[model samples]
Target chain A: MTSDAAPAAPTNPGLGALFVGFLTISIQAFGGVLPWARRVIVERRGWLSPAEFTDMLSLCQFLPGPNMINLAVALGVRFRGIPGAIAAFAGLIGVPMVIVLLLVTLYEGIGPSPAVDDTLGAIAAAAAGLMIATTAKIAEPFFRARDWRAILIAAIGFLAVGIFRWPLLWVLFVLAPLGVAAYWRWRR
Target chain B: MGAYGQLIAHFAVLSLLAVGGVPTVIPEMHRHAVDVAGWLSDTEFTNLFAIAQGAPGPNMTIVTLIGWHVTGLGGALVATAAFCVPCCVLTYFVFQLWNRWRDRPWRVAVQAGLSAVTIGIVAAGALVIAIAADTNLARFAITLATAALAWWTRLNPLWALGAAGVIGALGFA
Candidate 1:
């Protein structure tokens, strides 16, 4: 067998495995899926080495749309092409979509009582706090690098979009290319 | 265009521009959903965001919830598909190309710069949601405490969220 020739060859998971893997990750993801994704894809399945998963994740993050969904599509395609991509995407979204819809339906059924409203409001506040934590976590890398230009750019982005309420499209159109150029010049 | 058509158009554009993730595009989502189209109120939007966060799934559940609120199951399906399909197709095609150019300096610089800006944008989005959600001092304090716990501790965020829910149920907030 070719196994002797290439001892390091990674196992190519079947499409079913791809679906099941993403499904498990989706179900376990309460606040976020990236950690669970790392566990399942790297430690549990051994489908991708830790380094490979990191590399893949970096690429996925750089792409548009949700990072987790992009990772799902990328991993699926890498292993089994388009059909695999479909399987993984479907698995990732299928059950969660149903669950969310059901919750919405339930909310609608319960109507808007004062106590229920207060509970949801409190939950919203906590959820917003989670968003704050997320911001700190993502910003940590910039803090470590002491990249002032990037920091400035980020600040400007926040001011323009978050505070001033400028249209996101216009703000990004101006900021993204400038940010790219600044980094390009510095590195060059 | 109809509401379904508008949902597709709006979310589809947001899909490609969601450089970091869904959170990065949330302020704009709030703008369109709350300010422009008048589809949902600020409180309704925040509630949906909280519900999606508390649920066990991807963060994109907010998008699904919004869709369900506006039109129904069909809207949910369409909104989700519109948000996901364009970007996934782009990812599929670009995966091989990205691998080929992985080591290039231009790619490195782009990643570094965009990621920095993405961080700022995400923070802003978080701030927008925070302002909408934290309407009073007690609620704001809960937000601050939850943020601290999430950032400093290894405990699951679900615990903090659950505690806040109980506090609310007790009529404390």
Candidate 2:
């Protein structure tokens, strides 16, 4: 039951490769990073197969913190231990942070203009749309699997967090266990 | 003891609790930064979130904005490091154990369970952001159109965002 089978031989990307790859991903990903990360890692680099990328992404998603950041660490460690991980992490975040700070400073200086506000408003709305589309894509697998229990749990989660506006910590504590138990029992 | 220490401590706790990623902690962050610490106003928080979404890189860049708001460049650096390092360290250690347990039934169960929950959480986040962003009919239309275009086509999302921005600049949306 070795899960290490790569459809193709895995390329051992060095720390520099990891850094540059992630840096490119960071620069190109305007609204969200995931799509660019997928393109660069899975498609361009072929460092991991599609299935491997999905599995890694699922694990990263399951853990805490930002999914992409966790992904950088996990992917980095997979290739070259702590230094590789740091390379990837720094590549993913460092330049972007500088840019964000610079933008913030520029925005502060500009003050509030109705035209700028209108543009930001439009961008925000489009961003929201992008989020909704992302959610649909994420849910597609469950929809394909006909996993009613999983779907139910997700629905309950949405209702609790979105509609009821319950605190996320409470929602996770209550639902995560139940969801896990259901899957556990079903497997048995 | 000092502002940096307080900032580090605050974000370190948030770092661990950021399940489903940084967006999950938006409300808590707002409460602490705005309601309690009095670091930023409600409008500022909303604008920061919006700007982060528009900017390139990870969604968590909002942490940098928050930190910048609190204590300039030093605050931004401290906040981002505190929020990320602990979580990355945890992930680094856990990834080994997880790969070892790759064949475990419980692991499968946990993954399956959590994937569903993740979808739900992401959906909830989308709803929250949509509500926050769509203040008027035109804004709402842009949102719906962008979503529909993204969902139905293979076109890149950037195009939609650009179009929305153009519409806004033209005062159409």
Candidate 3:
């Protein structure tokens, strides 16, 4: 008597799989994709569990790239290896890229009309507001924690460029290391 | 510099520093483009940055605007692709290796610093946008209100932007 047990099939992610994953990030995202991302990739889709997604997010926070983009690459690798990673990266940047190119063409075609100028100006104002709102909302917690150093950094950095008209790279060159050292001390 | 060289240099530098997005590089770009290269004036660059951000898509499109200023459409493509590719390559390898030591203290410091720098850069960008966009009191008021609305309400940014444009055209600003 002989008993045969079939070996388990390996889950090898392919380029196609990675492409699908890339598409997922783009279409799923609307306003932003932080908390919602966790929902889709982990809770809903089961690509990752909450704990695993959290782990990914934490590492991405430190990395010198867009956190979402970082996550997409990491996740792609998880599914399809390095090729998967490439696919995900391309999908994330490349998809939005086509739109960017088209927009530039249209911008040139529109030339400088009254409507165009006014629309652009209004959008600029709204963008300013967007940045301000982002700052206030994001900085609120840092303030509440009584982390005056970051606040000072923000204020000083702002004034350095906004008022003093110093170059940004110069200000960062002077401030970044000092800020890091000071943060190290403050935490201690 | 020749057009190709300038395009390559600009995008390459932008690629290295494009943490949090292109606005993080705005101040530096402004220094290089407006101050150093004499490519565009402060107001012109600011206006372009604002226009790019205010548009319905990715912020990287401003690279095109800069490209157009320096060397026209071809320049724009070169800068955009140059900026996009290298970063994409680096990101793949970095992410693959991150999990091995994700919790180290150095990692913590890096993230804290990145967010802070992003905040600082974005704040500066806003001020620049304000200066260029608010050519008059009404427009300035619109900018102020936009800021308030964005902070208080969760309204879509595009709608507000459209409304503000109408006001501007009507000479309300």
Name the candidate that leads on TM-score: 2
Instruction: lDDT for model 2, please.
Output: 0.83
Off by over 4 Å in 2: A1-14, A28-58, B27-50
lDDT tens string, model 2, B1-173?
A: 88889789989999888876777787888899899888899999988876787788998999999988889989999999999998999999999998889999999888777767767877887898899889999989988997888667757667888898889999987
Model 2 chain B: lowest-lDDT 10 consecutive positions: B149-158
- Per-candidate iRMS values, in order, are 6.5, 4.5, 9.7
lDDT of 1 by residue, A9-39 (tens): 5678899999999999888665567655755
Ranking by lDDT: 2, 1, 3
TM-score of each: 0.72, 0.85, 0.64
Q: DockQ of candidates 1 onward, in order?
A: 0.46, 0.55, 0.28
Alpha-carbon error at A128 in model 2, in Å? Answer: 2.1
Question: What value does the lDDT take at residue A100 in candidate 1?
Answer: 86
lDDT of 2 by residue, A94-136 (tens): 8889888888888889966789878867887887887787677
TM-score of 2: 0.85
Error of 1 at B71 (Å): 7.6
**Candidate 3, residues A1-188: lDDT per residue as tens digits?**
01011223324447775566555555433223442344345433556643455446544533444556666777777787777777866665555555555665676677557766666665566556555554554555557777677678767777887777776656766766666666666555
